[model samples]
Target chain A: MSNGARNPNRWLAFSASIAVVALTAACSSGGTTASPDTGTGDGGSDGDVVLEFAQWWEPELPDGVLRGLMDEFEAENPGITVELLSGPYASTKEQVVAGAASGTMSDVVGLDGAWVSDFVQQGAIADLSALMDDAGYDQTQLASQVQLDGSTYMVPVVNFAYMLFSNDAMLADAGVDVPSTRSEFADAAAALTSGNTTGWILPLSLEAPNGIQNDVMSWVWASGGSMLDNGQPDVTNDDVKSAVEFIVDLDSAGVIAPGAATLKEQDKVEEFTNGRVGMMISSLAHINTIRESNPDLEFTISALPAADGYSGERGTPYASWGIGVAENSEHKAEAWKLIDFLMSESSNAQLADAANAFPGNTTARPEFVDNDPIFQEAFDVWQAGYPANEFVGLPVAEQLMRDFSEQLQRVLAGEISVDEALENAQAAWTDEF
Target chain B: MTATLTPEVEAADRQPTPPSSRVRLRRLWDRLTPFGFLSPTLILLIILMVTPIAMVVGYSLMDRVITAPESNFVGFENYVEVLTDPVFATAVKNTIYFAGVSVVAHFVLGMGFALMLNSPILSHRLKAVFRTIYILPWLFTIAIVAVLWRMLLSPNGIVNYLVTTFGFTESSVEWLSDPNLALHAVTFINIWSGYPFFMISLLAGLQGIPRDLYEAARIDRAGPIKQFLHVTLPQLKPIVISMALLDFIWTTQQFALIWMTTGGGPINRTEMVSTYTYKLAFATYDFSVASAAAVIVLVLSMVLAFFYVRHQKSRD
Candidate 1:
């Protein structure tokens, strides 16, 4: 054995390597120890019940208003501190999911109504019936939407109902009426479309959660067609077929952009903002965004045009991002207390300010616009609304609807036939459901 | 007084140890030393690499939900689902298409460009500057590149502006929305980011080959093409394979650029396995299904790596 070659340095290398491995494991495992400090409570002894609120992707709500409300809550509670924690938007679900699965859910977490059923099925949520009752909340004031096994899983939050928002100026420029009926709306959209403008900005892509069916539904319900003749895809029915065909016909007649299938949710807003679109159907959530882009521009919100037969038909929107407490929360009393604070008119007002949505609580509506006319108009739409039907909202079902919309776009693009598109879509959904 | 020491001095100088004892000590030392040498790296690998892999495999085996804590076992179903699902199938197809075409392009054009720069007539400083500039894209975040391309490829983009100005067409292209063109657009960005590495590696390989080989070829009346085919290509084979394999794996797992540019939309034409898996796990909150899809992807990746290692071994 050569003296230098057979070295004592070997042990040093071995020990160092072992240390590296140990550290790497510790880092990669993400060291779980009930990350309890995640925004529900202030960790310090300031005599305040510190609560943390988290959201992802910079969901900026009106800060000054929320702070004012939280401050008021703190003043009343004496020793309670409320903190807002912003998390990554996409990964917020991951954290909450991982947390809930581990029985370590935050005191309050924002759950999308779309997956609220799955969450309930997985036993991840608390039934809020007792809490609302205890808090003296008026159940009748709640919107009559979203039936889940004959009970509501969660209450509404800031919402975006699919209403037609158009530049009133643009409509006038196109020589189109404010479309009183379905056929007229199509003709109006057609009359308005030009080289730089699309007539209507109904969702042409399957991926938009605001499904093309709803655009069709605006007509169907307006036209006396049933979405579900009780828990079945009535899309094969003549009313649904005709409504879909009408949309497809609009596209063929050059009302929609040829590249409409790829249009993102943001594009319609751009069209409206740029005054390039005539009349567009979008959620009221975008009112601020469009307003910001063209402040002086005049726009109006209207219900989806009526079908000839039905007296009333409106675009139905599902609720998104409702807050709920953990069923088995260690801080159940504290949690309920916090939830009450949130549900209070002031908190609702803050939420309306932050998320630009209709309030879950009824009295919170007036606080929204500080008595502005625009807020009153929004309040009207909320009154006219129906909760998004939950039975057809199996995540896969929504995905299938999206796939169906793509096929619809294809038919409109003249890439495929209407019958072919529908047939293919039916096959896709049948395979899924 | 001379060179020979006194008996006391000689005895003080050293003692002769037992041969058997010395041998035993040496054996123990050798055994202990190797473990000492390897323990650090072995620990790191086990902790960092192997543990996460094991965890992924464990997660894949379980019926995990997004908001669920305790997970139960579900075997082979993820693989079946991944193999059978249309979205997954499309993802696999697109990933292969992206990697295959991109790597091939990188190999050919990268080597050609590097060779042109490697020429003696080009000043070395200028060549170095060009090389650095070419490699700049590699340093940029995928998001930035996606955004840059988004602006450049939009219907009202500079590239479209240039084309329209040059009378290519009356209207600008809806590049990303067109399924036929979207993958190509993504592929072009990938090539821009990837080719520099191929060029650098091939250039390094080219420099390692003796000028004498070219001289020998010249003596044999070899043309530049013949010389390259015989001398240059053979030497660069190792670099090409390694680069291609690397580019393949990177491109297969590439997510950020595509996700930013398009959410795998326009009928999911751009949906890779990675993005699809992400959407499943994160967006859909179907972690079990996502885990299964991910595990399938992991296995496919391993298979590709295995082929690469085997190829390297065979070549050696």
Candidate 2:
């Protein structure tokens, strides 16, 4: 910081600090559920305890409904007021990393179950075993949420299982019945497949392409393939390769979208919603968003289209979101209170009413499943035992997903073979790891 | 200066102590005040700019998160990995292409607008009205700009609607979906949002030029194109060059608009250096590699700047 260069940056930092302070105040004000007792006969201006909550569900969720709940929680507690901070899903990992390093983490955080390992590795999150016990949450369910290191950092909220959804009218219009077996599925897809319509729409957008992969797993598991063998990376495994080859051949058959390689994530949603496609391997959670977009469209939900080499046991990963306490929080007790409330039956029911999500608690799942037809199918998938194993490779895994997608795009664009694309994914994952 | 006329009698003994010492002290104060005034700013800059940059540079050289706190220092491993990576190479090429093409297009369109507004044939009132309207896009916050563009360029958006109505195309084009078109689509918005700054600047530059220079040129048989090449361009040189520099930097690091509209997709054919760096650092949390990418950005920008400044020096 020489004399000449120092001044401009100083101004930028000062301005940034002032802006952050103002933003903090604005954020804090939004969560002020007025405490009934704090307003009178108290020496303190506001409650001394300031609870903190962090979540990665913003932008997707409707504006601040969860925050409103927190405010009410605060108002109910005379000596406590909760403050909520939000980060987008993509940045949630980084926020925790940076926030932890800088000692600025909120008292409580919301995270995806897949990220539990990374958080544990970095020591960025804390074990919530005691936190769960205090609330009387189920231990087996809590253990399922724990990382490989045996620490339960996540208080699981939303339970997501991917399922195959069909545009029933489109299939009827195309004179094709909903397919059950691999052969039937292929035939049905071929009949409906056209320039304007693909037999199926699945996003191959390498990053967060989990929904499509989850559906694709139907064939993989059906073909007796496994993504990993006994909780280990197994890219070179025979069953996995055979399963991948099935999709590759279908890709060659032109049953998917022409621009599938270049399609945006939202494009897939629109394709399904706008009746441009007949089937999509999508989330049961997205049913409401799609249904709301086109209420008149008749749709169906079913288990993954059956494939050859069927194994009765399904292979899947839990795509769950959870809540946790921030390690450095000054108001840990209050945060725990809010977490407990949100975990309770009433709050869980409210959450189900607000959005379509399977609550992770065995007791709460019934409330969430009753709301939508698609979610019922999701529950069936869960019953079929398509267990979502812990996400392997972590930070490297995300990079690999992106890299794999880019290579897949090339294949989709007619620039390469599917075999080569898989090879590239292997290489990319190896290099990253 | 004889000691107040020998004190005019003893009553005028102390005539403010011959004020020259005060004057010298005042001169010293004047010379040093700027640094004092600027000290607060300097300290802030060190904390924000210099320190963070240094930290990034250090992290760039490390293997990062693997052995992190205890990891032995490995110089340039991250940089070497990234520079050799095909993904990063594509990102670099795309970023360079974006900066080069957008800056040039901005200059031409901006200069054209400035000339149009400078025209004396238009009434002053009309010019002012058009000027105000032209700057509306520029005044909008970037998020607003992105939302507006998303609507205008969507598969069923207004642009495709207009094209269909005019019979220019048979169907709606997903303008930002095609790999070939996504970069251009993002660039189009960048240009739309950027050109006005250059236009406003060049117009002001045009205002400063003597109107009589054009009059003299006309008398000397110069046409509009000829006058532009000889007179207007020469006079607008400083602003044009400076605007070009600014455009290059701003467009290179652009993220928010692209994030909102595209998310670096259509298979990342829309990838730029800054966005790629962000995805690596924040989205993926690969700190060492992301820090490497950022350091590359800084080095490349500095090199580009050096060349531009050198060219300017040579010209001078």
Candidate 3:
């Protein structure tokens, strides 16, 4: 055959190849393209302003509660519409970080205290102090604001404290009351240990190493101990070392849960819900989850036990659902208006009630606390102790936690002494700073 | 037409005609047709692979990136930092162990299963059931495999329950937690999930083996073992080498399974190069160092690919 006779076949092959390439590219692109409605608030039809609010709290709260609040905000402010972009915490963090890096962050964002410093360093989030002032917001009403270099980048909208949760039936079965001191706590934990049950469940997984900040550091914070001295890592200080040693002692006593090195927070909660553990240091945010998972499980919430003979005011470890306006947002005013509404006393109270958390406004109190005895107890614990979390606003906070957790695991495994572990962690943290 | 031409006339006739633009264009088109066919793939490779690799190399030589607005060029400092880090060293060692053990185990398990499936004594229906059962692990996504293995290997999970029930130990075994067992446990899971690919390939190879060779061996009074050692192995040698090399390359770059299961934890006991690079980039926001680690991993992967290509070429 002449070469010209084969041209159609060659053309067919070329077209087929091109089509495959196009199809592959389309498939691999996936869901990365943003829809016009969700696109970073470039004004909707007919001069209406669209503000994208990205957060992780929507999934945690009762379904449609956040959307209802946003609808209310839109009703009050006619020209502004709020869009909710929500996902699980990790994915939200990833999306926000990617957005920040690409200069396409949403108008408003939910902030974690651990992420605040990094965002501030990247200039990803707006300085809310000026925005609040410009909007005539009552700054004094805010319970707390995460600040870096004296500029408030994020304001807490709701708060959840990490407290000691005890399975009441297990404690009663073991004939141990809620322990309020270190020695008593250790004794109670040991007494509660039996077949298929441990006294305490510690999730030390390096994947989500906040277990170190929440579970291990809660011991230090309870007695007003600090992992930082003047904004620098002081992890090798006596208080931190002592806390590590205490955890090692508990591990030695076999009261801490097995497989802790791989267990995550959800796993700890599951063990507690399944009645496999007697106690756990858990967030108040998990209260509803625990109840939903095991309605019959009787549990009590209380302030973590302090070191003996340390009769000073205790510090409760707390995490918050913080709010911030993105630096790249075009509708900053509208974003601030939404933030102001969310931080208002009534709205904050409603949100807190729905989330089973504390209102971020100082004057706001969720009505549920008055009716639920457990919530009342948690409120009392909050009132009696100051919220403390030293890792908050620290640079590379999660990495620091991972470093400390790795060293702590080494100590627990008897590969290193407590002192050595602390020193190693200190060295690792020092490099980060 | 039969009249003889002078030398000058023949030379003039032999001289090429001054072609029209259409003819010249067709000639050019002919020359460009092959490149036209290859253009789509070349463009995709340049965009998807080459660009990203070049960017990573550039980032590796910078002081900071992504998180920092202003990044400074630093000559090989990030590489020096990563190479000197003790965790990086541990990651390299663990990656070698994890991949090496996984590849070897995959080959053994795959060969055993393939042999069973290819056995003449096995009924067709029974062989089909066995094949399905053996390939079930490979059907699961990496995420599902990680989660399933995590549940099975938990201290309070079924595996531990069985171990304790059988009086193997007085208490639950921490398969994924204990530093001593975590690397091996994850490697075992990798092996379980990976062997099916090799099994399928080897089964095809086994089926393609000529019956004449086995009959010849039998004529020579060869036993089953001797036939397998001689005719079967010789027939499967090229495929075996190719599959093993490819599996080794893929296994060494494993990230999802390790990330979902262990996160390279228990004091870096299970840390691999992928996890190390991930943590540097995402956890610490140290893109520069992460890029350096990534480039190192890329180089290692390229070396493995090199061996694979060389083997395939030699076989061809």
Chain A TM-score compared with the true chain A, each model in order: 0.78, 0.78, 0.92
Q: Model 2 chain A: which ten-residue window has the lowest total lDDT?
A: A34-43
Ten-residue stretch with the least lDDT total in model 1 chain B: B305-314
Please tell me which predicted candidate would have the highest DockQ against the true structure. 3
**Compared to the true structure, candidate 2 yields what TM-score?**
0.80
lDDT by residue for model 1 over A94-209, one digit each (tens)? Answer: 56666656666666666555556566756766667766666665666554324357655566555656666766877788777678677888888887787777777665443344
Worst 10 residues of 3 chain B by lDDT: B305-314
Ten residues in sequence with the least summed lDDT for candidate 2 chain B:
B63-72
Candidate 1 docking: what grade? incorrect
Off by over 4 Å in 3: A1-39, B1-23
What i-RMS does every model get?
Answer: 7.1, 8.9, 6.2
Model 2 per-residue lDDT tens digits across residues A303-395: 666555464665544466677766656555566777777766666656644556666554555554665556666677667765553343254
| Root-mean-square deviation (CA) per prediction | 7.3, 7.6, 5.3
- A best-first ranking of the candidates according to their lDDT comes to 3, 2, 1
| Global local distance difference test of model 2 | 0.67
Per-prediction tally of clashes: 23, 7, 0
CAPRI accuracy category, model 2:
incorrect
